[model samples]
Target: MNDDTGGGPARGVSGGSWERATLEKLVFATLKEQRSVRRWRMFSRLLWLAVLGAIAWYFLQQQTLGAVQSTPHTAVIEIRGEIASGASASADSIVSSLKTAFEDRGAQAVVLLIDSPGGSPVQAGIINDEITRLKGLHKKKVYAVVEETCASAAYYIAAAADEIYVDKASLVGSIGVLMDGFGFTGLMEKLGIERRLMTAGENKAMLDPFSPQNPEQSAYIQNMLGEIHGQFIEVVKRGRGARLKETPDMFSGLVWSGPRAVELGLADGLGSLDTVARDVVKAEDIVDYTQRENLGSRLARQFGASVGEGFFLAAKASGVQLK
Candidate 1:
């Protein structure tokens, strides 16, 4: 063996084996580094899975709602919610529902089973106008059956109906226009708050409820109320025609029970929803058209509404200071 050179055949073989062992260690370390990269990718994949699950849940909810609305039905409609613009009997809600009902082939007639204390005049007028137009176009029979109360704007709407029925104790008729606001003159004085109002016109702040009332202002307000009341009287007379009894006390903003209403010629008969549906509309099926928002959606809407209201209040409080 060439021991001096350390390159004898056997010695050379041992050196080559040592070099291969060193190379193997480096390759194993590189494999472990690649494994660490794979572990990071797995973690990211898990996060994306959670995100996808949430998205899938949202879509599933939406699909469920869509399916529920797709269910079909028959017969008359139920108008048993509050009547107001943007409040309950919103124009959009009522008109859309009415349109759907009219389009339904099975629906023979539209029955307004009303039981409300009345609300927004504009909303009521719009609804009345729509009802009139729809009746003329479709030649459909529309009946207003007052359950408990159909006063003010509610009665206004009822006038548009082909016929009106009421229960014995139902309070109907508040045919008048009235505005209410607190007079904070005393409270402001008591609290030592300064009154600083600047108006471009004399009547710009004519109806300011915070300021003291002058004789001229009082006369103006009375005249305005009288005018509105006159409008209400005219509408009632037009709708009821010869059916409305001519009496000095008829337009006295009097509220009467259902039985009293019939005596007063405000309603045609006495009955309830079922009686009206079976007897008048001749259909027992009822459909609701009012908006149906979920609790979360409703809460979100309420939150946004309250926020907007607070913003306006802050602005009015800072500038107008009028009640």
Candidate 2:
């Protein structure tokens, strides 16, 4: 009976010891899982903090640069790429830069560094008017230094400058307007497809590529283009005065080399930004007053554009341009 009782106690103790060991193992495993989760959460938080810190630093840097003042320098506003309403070389951005440059006490003169194939005429006209107004108000001479190609709308803005400088090999003309598109009517006919378009007014579908060409509409568009062309010619005449040597093909949508342009009185002489700054403005040091879009703004613009790309394409198909 004693042996039996001893055996029973020994078995009970062994079972209790096994249960305690299993419980200890489970507790340790649970603690390890919690520790891993906590580490990951901490790492994620740190990563987000780092990104926020970087963005803050970038904006602060830009603000600091804009606030700092320096000795007398030539303030440059870059007009590169297509000068559309929402583009980098837009009238609003250029005009804002011009205002800042003109207002600054350290700015000796304003320089327009142009390199473009041209874009919207309306935008160019706004910039041209502002340049003239600013020049009169501030009494600061504005110089246009052309690089590569300065044509159509680009030249429209440059016309407001006191003088225009260009490289010898640069293309400096194409003083004209255009409205470009493709006619898919022929292709649709070949593919045996039908176009069912609805419009509120007869003229609403005037330039629709899928519809047959209307002679009356075409004539009206031609007349309107001629009027705009006439206005462009008058602007050039006013800007160049007696310097321009008018020719039959001067405004015939023809591009000219820089040297040829100077001979034809389209430009002043062969010069670059550096030479013009040192000789004309008398300021060797240059400071850019151009307003640039920040990273966040660019990313937001890109995201919005992606969402509206289809709508933009449809409108662009029938839009007029100055190129």
Which structure among the candidates has the greatest TM-score?
2
Q: Please, what is the TM-score per model?
A: 0.68, 0.76
Candidate 2's residue-wise lDDT over 1-323, tens digit each?
A: 99999999999999999999999999999999987786666556555545655775687588547734468889898999999988999988898888988888888889999999999888999999999999999999999999999999999999999999999999998988888777899999999999999989889999899998899998899899898888788888888888999899999999999999999999999999999999999998888888887664554455554435433443444473323
Counting clashing residue pairs in each candidate, in order, gives 0, 0
Cα-based lDDT for every prediction: 0.72, 0.86
Q: Estimate the overall C-alpha local distance difference test score of candidate 1.
A: 0.72
lDDT of 1 by residue, 258-314 (tens): 887787788889877677667777666555444444454544454555545554544
TM-score of model 1 (CA atoms): 0.68
Pull out the clashing pairs in model 1: none
> Ten residues in a row with the worst lDDT in model 1?
66-75
Off by over 4 Å in 1: 1-82, 294-323
